[model samples]
Target: MLTMPDVRAPRLLCVEVHEGRPLSFLTETAAAHLAALAARSVFVPTTTRTRKQYRRIHLPGPPAPYAICANGGHLLVDGESDRDWQGAVARRLAEQCAPLAEVLAHLERTAHPDWTRKLRTAEELFAYVVTERALVPELWLKELSDWAGQRGWSLSAQGSKVYLVPRPLTKSAAVAEVVRRAGTEVVLTAGDSLLDADLLLAGDHGWRPGHGELADQGWTAPQVTALGERGVLAGELILAELLRRV
Candidate 1:
């Protein structure tokens, strides 16, 4: 839990829109905890965000040595994507899942423009559709999920975005690479979405907020602690707990 719930909050703005408007903020306490955690450990920001999108957030801490972006399709080392890693991921996706073009064409044929706001391809690895959550039919979503599943892809709807990602493109895979390079045995992680489920499971210890797709599904595991806090408060608690453990 590392961000403020209210955009209007006076907390330290950590993420911003392309136009420079505040998108996410971190409380001073959370910021301090994150900074401390970074000082002691290899703090990696693992996310489903594309490399460009991940760069928008200025998290409070020394810059992380590695970041897993595009759901592990790209690994950033010192703010630049590792080309060798990208090539490996590309090969994996080519072997494991249906091509991105096929998925994109299916969406174009099936998705209704009335509900779909935009269809985007991230890192040319996966596709997502921005939709009005309420307007999206459950049956359509289920069907889409089934279709993706059959093709070695998975669908997750978080907030207003529905992601159709290749099953092999996972954050945990990239994190393992980082761990190997860092030569660390103990791994800790935190996340609050379906995309993050694998990462949480891979960690020796992990945490999830009371909100997001995983929380909504009541997902949990023995090594993962499920917190009751929501929003940015949850982010603060996660960082605090991580700081304590490290």
Candidate 2:
């Protein structure tokens, strides 16, 4: 086991980050305002997506302390990836289930050539994905589930997309590891998708923007404090509420 310093929750403030995608809605002016409230912060951006995808998008300012990438697979301190954390993650993946080679083989077979845009795997987290928004067939999700289940995996379909992931890999699980290292009083969390449901419930309290997978399905945790606001407004509202509780 990797030895770590004792960390108390940071007043329990957490957010499910879908890369930096949601932040793109806010103008530079609005983003600056939002960043100001969370200064000197430890932002745990939990996502099912990978770190490279998160880096592709830009946010307004640097998140102080650290920013989580790859759905918590990587906890970046001052923008540098943590080696020890990643090592532990690697160990978990090995013990968990299907190997990357096995998953990729299944992906290659079941994925449609015309619609498949990307086939990605994070060996550290033991996850795979096939994203094709416009080319999805009506029965794609059901078929994907059958394929994944046969291989002892799970599939999740978010808005305009689908994901193949292992049952042991979860965003909230990574966030919990970060919290143990942070040594704070609480954790505040937010997200708009079903992958985020775990993080929302895992935290002391959370916030859900007006859109994304969970919002569409009307999924809300009792403590998550779902916001009715939409788009940029939702981003603003979430930032504001997080500061209020902190």
Query: Cα lDDT of all candidates, in order?
Result: 0.91, 0.67
Query: What TM-score does candidate 1 reach?
Result: 0.95
Give the range where candidate 1 is weakest over 10 consecutive residues by summed lDDT: 1-10
Badly placed stretches (over 4 Å) of model 1 are 1-12
Cα lDDT tens digits for candidate 1, 200-241: 999999999999999999999999999988887888889999
lDDT of 1: 0.91
In angstroms, how far off is 236's CA in candidate 1?
Answer: 0.5
RMSD of each: 2.4, 9.9
Best by lDDT: 1
